[model samples]
Target chain A: MIFDTQRAIAWINRIAELVRADVERLTTLDTAIGDGDHGANLDRGMTAAVDALAEKEPETPGKVLITAGRGLVSKTGGASGPLYGSGFRAAGKAMRDEGDVVALSDALEAMLRAIEELGGAHHEDKTMVDAFAPAVAAFQQAAGATADMHTAAVAAAEAAEAGLAATVPLQARKGRASYLGPRSVGHEDPGAASTVLIFRALADVTAE
Target chain B: MSSSANGGPTPPSVGIVLISHSAALARAAAEMAAALAGPEVTIRPAGGTDDGSMGTSIDLIGTAVREADSGGGVLVLMDMGSSVLTAKTLLEDLDDDDAPAVRLADAPFLEGAVAAAVLASTGADLQTVAESAEQAWSMRKL
Candidate 1:
């Protein structure tokens, strides 16, 4: 059985809340090289998107994500905004027609398209793409092998975290970290770090 | 919290808009807002893309603003640079009834989210809430 709109919303909410609790830490990392609002900006964007959804309460998962995508697009004014927005928009597109279950492949395709269309960045670019790419690929592979969304989500979350950790030694090519050159090497990509949080939320929610 | 849908006597509930250049930032912002905002206020985020050609489409953003405003005012927050232009475009796209009085938030991210939520919870108008957010952001060192 696949999770539906309400479950998805709950997952998003949990992720948002977890990130909110850590906004200060995230921004501190951003403060080192970037504008320092990474955590604050993301927190604001997610909060706003959730509020919009609560007010409108779209009946379907597609509508919910679409509403969220639009909200993120307008509210977040940084590099990550459109990428995340487009990702949800892609996910929404895939889930436009729903049954009892949402296929892992459909979710993967939508998220990949969203990242590609919005950021124009690729895997191993030392951005969130680093984490997202690995997570999606792992999720797809796991899902293909087994029809368990919960297991797939958990595997993806782990892969995402591992990918995020791997970014520590990689050279920066995207976002503000690119400007820092060698200085960007040791620090974790904030975007990748946050994506892991999101995937973890999804996994936890599904497990429940 | 009690909120009035457009044209009500109570100070209209504030609406939130987030503008960022990063998809991760946008996602993170949306996640933050949900944690802080109460049930009455409406928050929406618009993410920017890295491609110079790609941006938050004004029409699409305006629709969200209009929908959230519901005859109230909207407080828009942007990360930097082009986000200002993007917010302006979104405001221009609003229809008469759909468009609420649009205010640009001063506080960057956390500060803005907190201020917006406080004002929204208290039934502050878009302009006042936005002004407060700006003050909070401007005074901040980082």
Candidate 2:
């Protein structure tokens, strides 16, 4: 249970930074079949979200995530914004009035629900859900085995990375890529890749 | 030319709309256009949610399409299927009186964006610019 206001802020910043760092790579991935702006749009949205957070830091972790979600929705101006926004919004909803510290299981469940509700994507959809669903499940499972937040975060990040890699072989069932049908088969989903970056950053911040 | 380069009258004005299945993807497209267009152009966007919610109001998008059609025409760029369908619906939603005469700028976002931006910079009216965009797309494909 490393879910404090500070940890929340760190999580937002970490995700933002990674998206910012990998914008072009993600864009290239998107160019394979879908529109080639996933990286650029996501980075832009996260940058604005971070800036908003800097201007007015929230007192609660939930508040911070909510702010991040809305900013991405308004500033990013695309499918990714709403989907990611829904993810943050869902997480925030789960944490409502839950005080400063939340169990790792709680965080995982919140995020998983957020992704599902927002993206309307499923585990095998070959979207970010592919990475997120597995990662959260792994994190939750690991949390039951260990009381260490760092360990849970690390495991979650690893699962997310593996999930992203797995997307290379899977066919996309959702999003613009889905239109291409079989053409979408080989390309790694940029959304999943960007998602992995966010989770990896979370692991970095939560790692003790 | 030199004086204008140092202190030009002002740049042309452009509006942007990003259409995608996910609001995040639309936002990403708008963000890129903003970077390329600089601070001067007004960028507008409409997108769907992760769950496939329409990104912008159909009425509002109709207005943008109409507005673009006012003089030259409107350039509509679409990302995916529903976006195209929604854009189509937006056009169809318009009453004859409410509708703005427009052209669908059929091009990849990157090329269409550049075309739109350049046309705007040159002060081409929306219809003319949109026509130019469509033409550009046609030529590029050829």
Candidate 3:
């Protein structure tokens, strides 16, 4: 199933709902090694994204993502805001007018690239890249195998979840968590966990 | 202080923008730096998220940078983590022509802002102000 503009908006809104539901859990994950505001900040951003999308009702999938990104940047504070905003913005640019499986793969790849470029973080740094990188890879591989968007999204979501879990026991090398050094080894990265939710939302939407 | 050649109000040679996670913290730091820099320097506090929560805002920082600039340039002093990321992202978004000669100082937030502010108040150029701020990193308090 190819994702259109409406579908994309719905997916993002669904992610907002999921994020709102998991706010406390995400904040708990953050409190262990971070500033403990990840969930709240992201919830604010996602809520704003949904509202902005609903108000503008953009015509293309790309436009919807871009509007959502802008909303996040403006509404969400902290490093995550700019990082995630850049990712979504890049994905939107990469998607252009195409909503095929290949385009989705390219968009996810672009999102990862933007996050890395903006955040100066790489895979295994115990950042969102941990989840996003594997998700992008899985998406690209699945896109290569078939044209089914749902299949690729499922693969990506599963990879992201695994990556999120893998962040535990890894010492943070970037962000505020890095200040803890060895103390950060036992906690899952809040950013990576949130990334999993994003991919999962994508998969859920595509499956529906 | 020297007025403009045309007898108009003269702006400082450089401006300072303090980026912090807390709005009140940024404002207080800016005020402290302003006290040291005198009333000549344009010191703007671009802190917290848009809703006055704790976090850095790229839009707020960008706006503060523009507001602080008075033809000399702007110097950005960030607290840590996301503040630095947001400031750099804002710079990347600016067009070359509209983008001033802005520099993000890798110095201690309060000390750096104060040092940079004082330097700019003395009619120092943008580079000199930024260098002075960076010099604060080496200040030993032990």
Provide the overall lDDT of each model, using Cα atoms, as 2-decimal numbers.
0.71, 0.68, 0.89
Preferred candidate (DockQ higher): 1 or 3: 3
Q: Which one wins by lDDT: 2 or 3?
A: 3
1 or 3, greater by TM-score: 3
Model 3's TM-score against the true structure? 0.94
- What is the descending lDDT order? 3, 1, 2
lDDT tens readout by residue for model 3, A28-63: 999999999999999999998999998879999998
TM-score per model for chain B alone? 0.74, 0.63, 0.91
Give the DockQ-based CAPRI class for model 3: medium
Candidate 3 clashing pairs?
Answer: none
Q: Share of real contacts kept by model 2?
A: 0.05
Off by over 4 Å in 3: B1-12, B96-101
Give the TM-score (0 to 1) of chain B in model 3.
0.91
Candidate 1 off by > 4 Å: A99-104, B1-142
* TM-score per model over all chains: 0.61, 0.61, 0.94
Q: Which stretch of 10 consecutive residues in model 3 chain A shows the poorest summed lDDT? A: A96-105
Task: Give the chain A TM-score for each candidate.
Answer: 0.93, 0.93, 0.98
